[model samples]
Target chain A: MSNLFANQAPLLRTKTAPAAAALIASAGIIYGLVLCCINSLETFAVSFLAVLLAAILALWTFVRMAVKENDRGLLVTGAACMTAIIIVTVMPEGLPASFHVYRSFVAAALIIGLCVATLCSAVYRLLGSTPVAFDNSRYPILILPIVIALISYGMILFVLCLNGLPQISWQLISTPYDPANAALRGILNDILGTFMLMLLTSIISLPVGVGAGIYMSEYGGRIAGIIRFSTMLLRAMPVVVLGLAAYGVARMAYDTAWQGILAPDPTIMIGRGTFLLASAFLSLLVIPVITRATEEGLRSLPRDLREGSLAVGATEGYTLLHVLLPWSLPNILTGLLLGCAEVAGNVTVIVLLCGFGNYGVTPFTEATSLAHFIYKVMFADRSFRMSMGNYVYAVSVILLIITLGLTIVYLVLRNKFAERYRAH
Target chain B: MPATVEIKHLSVSYNGTNVVKDVSFEMPAGKVTAIIGPSGCGKTTLLRSINRLSELTKNCRVQGEIMVDGENVLKMDTVLLRRKVGMVFQQPNPFPKSIKENVLYGIKAAKIKTDHSDIVKSSLQKAVLWEELEHRLNESALNLSIGQQQRLCVARSLAITPEVILMDEPASALDPVSTLKLEESIQSMKGDVTLVIVTHNMQQAKRVADYTAFIYRGELIECNETEKIFANPDRSETRDYLEGKFS
Candidate 1:
């Protein structure tokens, strides 16, 4: 026992310097590697692309951390997306040119990253659990660097594989949107199309969902449980199954409404009646989410909320609108995002209903989505047909990026809305 | 400021069982009436019946006539009736809104067009919380201490300009400081509004009550002045319940 204290002191001290040395060396190695990559890569294509990809990934990661930090579960999901992107860079194709910039920036970032992480870890260890010494708000702004590093590290592999994954840069802003250039238009079109679809669908669903949620919560009574159960049961069936059901209904509508791709004819194929089919499909895909979310939100609202309003002589209608709906907006929006997230991936149903093979025709013929753009990109050049596999990986990144962006944006707005209306 | 609430042989039932059985009481003008009883006696039920607040209960059924401010409250439009009969809960339940908003809840809901500053100022002053909270009126009501919240609730009730205010053990959830503050406010509230409070604290009943009613097992046991109830009671049950003997 006498020897134990004396022996342990030097041993502990010795262990400390080595750990610190290892961390320093690792950061130094990353910095050196990044600068080397930046110096070697001289191409406009790969270098520029790598910068764009890295920055977007980092921004998405930062928002994901900030908005969804309410739960630890998002960490797993964030790690997975980052790791997947990393794996993409390390693959055979090599990252896009933008990777060189990303790596260079990352190497620059390592020093800042090491200091921030160490400080935060110490803060949490020393004061995080203790009461008077610290609080969540008083914690440092060090989270920013950590998010950037994780994103840069994960994107490194993608940059390597894509010939260079691009972190965001002024180049995108400088790059003109050239309508005459089909290649540029394809990328732009995918982005615009996804954004518009998501925005419209979300707007339509919010009021309808929030109102329904407030009503069912406030007034659903004994039947609310049953309404909730059936919605969950529906959710239990896969989204594709639900999407197929929408597809079938759409097909029947097309056959009934337009026989020859015009009104009053009843024999037209599914793709001809695109507008009606899309709306119906969109509604069916998202309504279940709206209904289910509202039910849970209403149930979760404390009884005192309603009672407080009612006691003040506000009728059920006023209480429901002003008090309940505003309070439940954040929760309801999360549900809407879930719906949006679910429906955004309906490539199978879209393909089947549109009757387009792999690539989408124009909206007048067969409107395709960004998700399906890879098919056209790879196959457009017969020489690149064998490497279509790369396109798969590339398009997947884009899809994930969009999904992550929408999710993060919606979540952040929801939180701000919740905070703004929080009772007073 | 004089108001009369007459409840005639009122019986309240929940899911078919009588919780308040044929209770009758007349709350005279310009006085504080306290309904004192053990847990689950008809005191709270009786108070809720007066304003038809019991209507909030899904299965609650009431067979009685409640007259307040010349309108039979039972037959009166509940939205209108509730505006006249304000209530404070056992816990301080301020809206998660600012103190100003919480105070304005009833006024805005009823769409009353009273003088804004004077209405707000007087109401807060009436509840005796104006000076302490004057600087923080825009802060969330929930941010206030529990005692201040109770007083804020009183201010909120006063803002509605009700003829009578019902409190279901208003001070029960408060610490002694808050409880005493509420009692002082209640003492100061008389002659301005009819106050009906249900409490288990017999000492609190003696503190500010002008008229006292003791309820037992969903039945009315006694009704008298505060002096008679404590010193000389007409019933043995009131004595047993008040004396620290078995209730």
Candidate 2:
């Protein structure tokens, strides 16, 4: 065991020189091997140089471990693995071209295994003692899954920014979309259309969701159970089914006398697709989210708040409005913003509604959304993807920013309310 | 003016089982009355019946007449009954609003057109919290300490000008200093509003009550002057309970 004072200090701070060197070399090997798997000839040359440098560092540390009579099993294993990687990488030219593709995979697997072993041994030496090592390993072991998840999300964001930032421009954001004209092509129509859809969806869903939630929580009865069951059923039903139902309803409205009264010009509102129809269906998608959130929020409040208000002679409705709703405002807003985000990113209902990009921007017009545009431009035609894939990526980034921005607002508001109320 | 409460043949049952069986008592007007009993002895159940708050519970049945002043509470409109008789819970439950707003919640709900500022001032003064909280009337009531919150709750109940106030173990969750402050507020509200406090603390009952009622196993064992009940009780069950034979 290490000295008591050394144990008292942080493990990383107390790491010996050899341990630090092994840690750095192992990290370098893992990074270099990842670069080699990128499948680009230009990066492969640079990646080999990185591997060579890391291998030299590992070999030097092996000599130091041998001289100091320290743990040498990991160093020996690391050196042998490095040798195997270098041989496989260098001898790829001697095999058939088809065999060369598999060469890098073999080298990457070997290097990853070695780096993992070297890192474990280095950390073990830093931790010291069997019981201390076991105790300390728990932190990283438990945190590893979340760390991997975060990295995956980070990689996606990084890739989006890399491919989309340069494509973004004032023209792309402000001009109308024109397929034949490169300079005139833009997503401005879809951007405005998406916002309008979000506004309409919220307008349609908020009152209904809040009312249903209040009924289920405050006036729970047989009817409330029925409402709860319907909401759960709606939440479980697929969006495509909602879209089809919307389509059938729109078709019926157009075919009947209502269309003669509402739409003398069929192009205005009675077409196969319109913003109003898409938003109505999207609100169906968003209602369940808001209702469940509102229900959960109200249910979580202390009974004392409700009983206290009622005890003061406030009617059930009055108490709900004044005490119950106000106390659970943060929770309601969280669900609202989450629903808004869901509305902003949804494409399925709109895709079934219209092949948007031809109509003017209005609630009754056939307007598309960012999500729909991305799905269309990416999957509708291969040639369009090759020429304008960057635009698709740009739309993705915008949609991500909008949704993430709403989520952040919800979190901030929740924290503010949580601090102010500090509910008992 | 403070109103007297007359409970006769009152029995409360939950799920077909009686919790308070054939209990009857009288709480005099303009006086502090304390009910002391063991846990689940129907002290709280009887207190809630005064305002019909116990009816909020599911499968709960209440039978018999509880008269406040002259009217039977069982047939009274709940909103009107609750406004006439206010309540305080064990934990300090201040609404999540400014102190002024919380004090005016009942008035606003009842739509009573009155001078709001005067009511706010007098209610806080009556609860003995005006000096400490006057400057912070606009602040959220939840920002107050537990003790202050309890007083704020009292002020809230007072704002609507109720004739009776029922407190269900109002000081059970308070610290010693807060408990003393609450007791002082109960004493100060005497003669203007009838106060019925339910407590397990024998000392608290003896300190704040003008009259004491002892209940055991959902029955009213004894009711008399506080000094007399503590000195010489009528029922052996009341004496045994007072001696801490069973709690």
The candidate that wins on DockQ is 2
- Model 1, retained fraction of real contacts? 0.54
Q: Tens-digit lDDT track for model 2 on B1-247?
A: 8999999999999999899989889999999999999998889999998999898899999998899999999999999999999999989888877899989999999999999999999999988899998899999887789999998999999999999999999998889998998888888899999999999999999999999999988999999999999999998888898998864
TM-score of each: 0.69, 0.83
Model 2: how far is B119 from its true place, Å? 1.0
Error of 2 at A309 (Å): 0.2
Computed on alpha carbons, the lDDT of every model, listed in order, comes to 0.64, 0.79
Q: Please state the error at residue A276 of candidate 2 in Å.
A: 1.1
Report the TM-score measured on chain A for model 2.
0.71
Q: How many residue pairs clash in each candidate?
A: 52, 0
Residue lDDT tens for model 2, A244-304: 7876766666756655322223654444566777788888888888888889889998888
List candidate 2 segments past 4 Å from native: A1-136, A178-183, A255-271, A379-390, A420-424
Candidate 1 chain A: 10-residue stretch with minimal lDDT:
A9-18
